[model samples]
Target: MGEIDTERQKLNCFRMRELGATVVPVKSGSRTLKDAVNEALRDWVTNIRTTHYIIGSAVGPHPFPDIVRDLQSVIGNEARAQMLNQTSGEFGHPTFTNGPGRLPDLVVACVGGGSNAIGMFNAFLEDKEVRIIGVEAGGEHGPWLPDGSDTDKHSATLTKGTVGVLHGSRTYLLQSPDGQIKETHSISAGLDYPGVGPQHASLKACGRVEYVFATDQQALDAMRTVSRKEGIVPALEPSHALHQTMEFAKSLPKDKIVLVNLCGRGDKDMLHVAKARGVVIDTDVKLNKTDFAQQ
Candidate 1:
């Protein structure tokens, strides 16, 4: 799966259990997505005859990358067809008679593990004219800093990490001197990662795709903006996309057509956000830094 979120995984497990699915807790490593994936892989290897490994992201083993790309192409295909239909209706010209169709001028998506961006970009990969922008969380480190200037405090790995193997793919990773995975932190839990998808790394290397950083403040502000303007409380991940979109809109021509992925909802982050804002949760409980840290 994408950079696994332990917080989301707990909620997923609870929901699965409620649906009568047997949930096996994987207790190893950091007891996070990486560990859970390793445990699942072991189980799949031992029970290949009966077990299924539900791979996430488009960068897994051979068939998985192709399979996921094909599956994700539907989003682009449908979107293309829909946009064509809308354009034809608006311009009063049938699709075929209107000559070659115009591709979307711009496509934007937030990249956590990069599945959605891959899926969306796959739709227009051959177009050669459309621009694809992937928004990544800037983490604690500010953007545009020179490489190696970043201390080990932030998790904006895509911009600062080295190429390596992570999760089931060869990608970019944040590692220590001995190559051990380093801990990462982000205000947006979804975009908090120690690595990026291999596809994204390759694209970045080739300059086929452009990556932008949306800081926590930008994402939080975008979240509030969308909530007020569109009445949509977007997930923190996609809020990053919105942040980029707003920036693009300001710089680009007005006629440019920009499509963005909203990704998921934001309900899961309320507690984390409330705590960050010092909203005084659990008023009956009080503790010093040592006790708080222990908890």
Candidate 2:
């Protein structure tokens, strides 16, 4: 991961290390997702025989994206099965159905590299009645430009990027007219990227899936909403999806069901969220005798 994300996402990195994985922090360029991916690709090519590049998201070249989507498809498979198996008493009897009975009117997920969204959408792709939506991070920008000219303030690749090649894949990318990759921003560390997966580009081109963006403030608000109302603290990545899901749900009838993929937990994002919201956490505060005694 990049140096910035390595620090912001320290808990996950530490957990990976505890599980016997070597976490390499790339300290070059913008020190963000794009730079990290570039470094990983460089290392993989140099030590092809000794290293296996297991990409976490559904980005990169052909086979890798396919592999990731296939592996992560378990999410969609399980969701679809659970939704369709109302007869088996899972999810109980639904108030509405997809003609065939008990299917989501909408399937939504947050799209950084699009692994999770692709995984969830794969199972429902054949179901033409299912409306699939992918949400991207809008950063601090209130709304993204249609032509992708404003690249620095948002990671809304599918929403605002131009078609270009990045990380060995032809996809929508935040780049300059000279084809140089541009910097992207998002409150969510995981969704800060310049390019999306090739499959997502194809989906966008074919109009099979709808791609939208949620602003940083909207996502933060949604995170708090879900945390307080549903007792589920979602990671910043999935909060974008939840924000869009809430907006989309309002237009639907009472019987319709919208499914949003909560792909990560908020445990890894607590500090980042606090800092973004201007809440200072004094980690260096000296413990009093009472504090030690409570522990």
TM-score of each: 0.79, 0.89
- Give the number of the best model, judged by lDDT: 2
Model 2: how far is 143 from its true place, Å? 4.9
Q: Write the per-residue lDDT of candidate 1 for residues 1-295, one digit (tens) a residue.
A: 3223545444555566789987665566645445555677788889999988775656555566667766776676656655555434332334433322456788899887677777887767677888989888886554444674665555566777787777667877878767899876667756766777677888898988888887877888898899899988888788889999999989888777888878777766655556556775563566789997997
lDDT of 1 at 159: 73
Evaluated against the true structure, the overall lDDT of model 1 is: 0.71
Displacement of the residue 292 alpha carbon in candidate 1, Å: 36
Candidate 2: residue pairs that collide: none
Clashes per candidate (backbone, < 3 Å): 0, 0
lDDT of model 2, residue 69: 98
Q: Can you write out model 2's per-residue Cα lDDT over 149-204, one digit (the tens) per residue?
A: 55368899998899999998999998888999888888899899989999999999
lDDT, candidates in the order shown: 0.71, 0.89
